[model samples]
Target chain A: MESHYFPIVYLFGNENLAVNLSNILMITVSMAIVFFVCFFMARKISMYPTGAQNALEYLVQFIKNIISSNMDWKQGKHFVMLGLTIILYVFVANMAGIPFELATQDHVVWWKSPTSDPILTISLAIMVIVLTHVYGIKMRGLKEYGKDYFRPAPFLAPFKVLEDLANTLTLGMRLFGNVYAKEVLMLMLVALGTSSLMWGIFAFLPTIIWQAFGVFIGSLQAFIFCMLTMVYMAHKVSADH
Target chain B: MSIFAIPYVRMNDKEANPLIQEFTWLDAIYQLAAFAVLLLLLKKFAFGPIMGMMEKREKHIADQISSAEKNREETEKQLAEQRRLIEEARREAKEIVENSRKMSSQQADEVLASAKQEAERIKETALAEIYQEKTQAINALREQVSTLSVLVASKIIEKEMDEKEQEKLIQETLKEVGEEL
Candidate 1:
């Protein structure tokens, strides 16, 4: 009962599929749209300036302004590109789920935010953690990488591995918990609104505001995730870090 | 339909318990394969080139902004220097005009004083010439009056004279006639 995150996983059809194929499609499509929009916005840049360039400039400035303020530019410059992709992609994917509804089979939720799923959140967190290690190795050679694991003592290397693992798992779990809980609340609330008449009118006012709030939270969480990625990298890569 | 309920919301509700089932290793493999395919597709068509360009353009923009800021600062410095130079030039021009004005006024005052002194000296010389002519005319008048007095005395005298005296008297009479003429 506790493990069931309704919107995250569901049956596809009588043919049957493992994951919620529809929700997964929503995620993939949303991510693709994020990628293409960012790409298209940046493809051409005029020396003078254009709308696309202006949009891209703002995106870049926004990321750099945050990254540079939070970390050293030399160590941090390479990070914004990765951070932007992750943040924008996740934000769009999360918000896209709000509008999802099923018309065919009444039981299925047509779409779900990818972050609401353990698999998606865990995958992303793993990506960030793996990248942190990869960048750490690149910045400081593999010798330093293994050596840092011993920091206080060589015997602590195993502990460091466990710590990193724990850290990654927490990252994924925290995101999944929040997104999944939000989806659950939304479903319950929406179900409550539709089950009656007076409740429906009362629910209408809040639903619009709550959906907007959801968008804000979705964007904030994505930003926080990306920001933490860079912060952890800054700690891991540099010797003084 | 049963797969969705594997993580069933209700453990006690008989409605969902029958749907709960253990996921097979084969299903996990299928999920892995599907994920691998998604990753591959993402790598080839989406993440690879798009991420590359995004990074490239991002770097280019950051560099351009920093460079532009540097140039703007340099231009501001140059502008400040030029402004200082222009101010100095204007100050010098004002000083030159003031000096020229002072020198011209001093020269004009000196010229007026000299012209006035020259006019006073010319008037004094003309007055001196008039006084000298008056003195010379007074001496000529005295000589004519004495000659006329001598002629009246000779006409009143009734006496004979020697030849030398008569000649002296005739010369005196001729002198009186010349004075009268």
Candidate 2:
């Protein structure tokens, strides 16, 4: 894969950092889309919602259900905003590359799903994991939160630490892998179509089918991401967990 | 060539590792910042107002329902009161009818008794009147009888002796008695 990099050198000339400009641009675009959709839906609210407002409320309710199912409302209420943000942002990011991927002839990708990149997805996962820890300490107090690690046996503490690392890796990689695979398959199909007329005809049907399936995968992945986020949050915050 | 080209870095296509190329702290930092901003804006503008509006609507609906229930109860109470009043009036009218009927029947009985008493008194007066008239006619007849007897005796004494003369006197006396009667 090709990328657009912007390098930043340390003032001491000790190290260099490369920023992926494509990811930045795509991430910003996705955020803007999510924000505008929410803004318009919430613009002229009424007692009885209709059209966009109805859809928006349904989304809110859907996130609320996900939160409530994992934990009680008192603990879950704080997470509704976080849940909405994740679901909307990840979903928009996942769907952004589907219709068409923007790239040069040399395969220099300028625009695609930001979530297809591991860095972005893992960043989101890290943020969520960090928030859960923050909330756990805030709600349960640090001593109680630390005691939660030793719950069935004091010997389980090491494995518990490993589990948090594993959880972060899987949560982030799951979204990245699915979206990346879909994009790769799409690119392959496009290449096959360009190779020959006969192949083009064959590739056309598969591409359309894959795009439709891609939509389902995108939406499902978004929901799964949110569900796991709340479940992880519940584990950290809830007394029973 | 672009405004974002100032920090341009040469491509490292030969690295042959997609994961190594994609992972960057700068991208992560930018994504985190962007996501945080989005969360803050959405919470303030969208979620807060909508949830508040929903709660208000729910309260309004509850108030309306309670007020409606109160109105229905009041109307029902009024209906019951009206029915009671109508029932009382009906009972009063019936009582008035009953009293008038009793009074009229009593008046009828008194009139009948007075009329019967008048008839009896009139019958007694008629009987007394008939008796008095009969007594007056009898007394007048008695006086005429006495006078006629006295006149006849005197004529017989005034003319006595010879047979032919006595017979002529007797005839004259008879004619005079008849004329006097």
Candidate 3:
């Protein structure tokens, strides 16, 4: 049962019993294992944090700092939830690419990054954009939101409205493009070495380089998603924007 | 923007493949759902603690700074007190030294005055003894001279009348010898 690299492997119904079971169960089990461990670690958090909780805190603090730095302590503090969610969820998605997809595949390719999928990326982006607007409207009433567009001149309001719309669309698309492009590039690089230059002396070097690049891009892209979320939110909720 | 979504097919060429994949509204819905999940998870656990810890860290740092400043001030104050104590001890030693010197000088002056008084008493007794001795010596000399004068007159009279004045002259000479002795 051969499959293209990172093809959407369905959870059930394949003719080969062994490979089908292997395909569906192993990756999901592994992800479930990661989820439960994270849950237990989260649940067991103490006043004096230990091991996994400490690691968790370090990640939490990192996002907290990012959010607080962008906005007011009170307003920024509220963004912590968003930051934490983005960091944790994206982190989980990014790490999904690490393990072997199935027991059958000699070189493991378990779970692809959820973030790499345009479906996932675009949804999160649009939500982030809408929430920013929602919070903006909440903070400064509908009148202020409308006034913000017309600010300094009543006539330039339409252009300003267009600019805002463009900005929101761009924000979402940018994240999708970056993550998708990085995943595609990594795949191509890996394919080039594994297929084309399998017997070539320099085959391993290119694969190694691209994998390293993949790791870097993956982490950066996750961070960028969260960063963009905070940036859009700050623009909306903050009085200055 | 919608042009990007349209298939880029080769209209002039007979052999061309249109791309199979297409973007759907379902994908957009999926994105929103994921974002909602992400936001929910963030709100529940992560945000509160991270922000709380940060605030705690900021407060802890501030406290440490204030305590450090307080400790420094206390140490400086202790050092000043120690220096002052040393200075005070030095002044006390000087006072003690000055007092001892004054006491010694006063004692010496008292001894000297007593010694001068003792010397005056001894001189006065000696002068009194010497006056008494001079008076005694003058009285004895007067008695001897008177007796000698009597004896001489008796001796001269005895020579003129040799045989008859012999007994009277002997009696006068005996009286002068007794006075001289």
Which candidate leads the pack in DockQ?
2
Model 1, A51-89: lDDT tens digits are 876666666667777777666788887776676666676
Off by over 4 Å in 3: A1-65, A72-74, A95-111, A138-144, A182-209, B1-54, B132-181
lDDT of 2 by residue, A1-241 (tens): 3343323222222234556767888989999999988998899999988787778888888999999999999999889889999999999999999999887655567788999999889889999999999999999999999999998899999999999999999999999999999988888887788799999999999999999999999999999999999999999999995
DockQ of all predictions against the true structure, Cα-based: 0.06, 0.27, 0.08
lDDT of 3 at A174: 65
Off by over 4 Å in 1: A1-19, B1-181
TM-score (chain A only) of candidate 1: 0.84
| Residue-level lDDT tens digits of model 2 in B13-61 | 6655655563467788999999999999898888767767766777989
Residue B22, candidate 2: C-alpha displacement in angstroms: 5.0
lDDT of 3 at B84: 100
lDDT of each: 0.66, 0.83, 0.60
What docking tier does model 1 reach?
A: incorrect
- lDDT sort, best first: 2, 1, 3
Give residue B152's error in model 1 in angstroms. 41
For candidate 3, write residues B11-98 as lDDT tens digits. Answer: 2222321111223344345445544654554445544454466567778889999999999999999999999999999999999999
Q: How would the candidate models be sorted by DockQ, starting from the highest?
A: 2, 3, 1
| Candidate 2 local lDDT, residue A25 | 87
Candidate 1 C-alpha error for residue B147, in Å: 40
Decide which is better by TM-score, 1 or 3. Answer: 3
**B113, model 3: CA deviation in Å?**
2.6
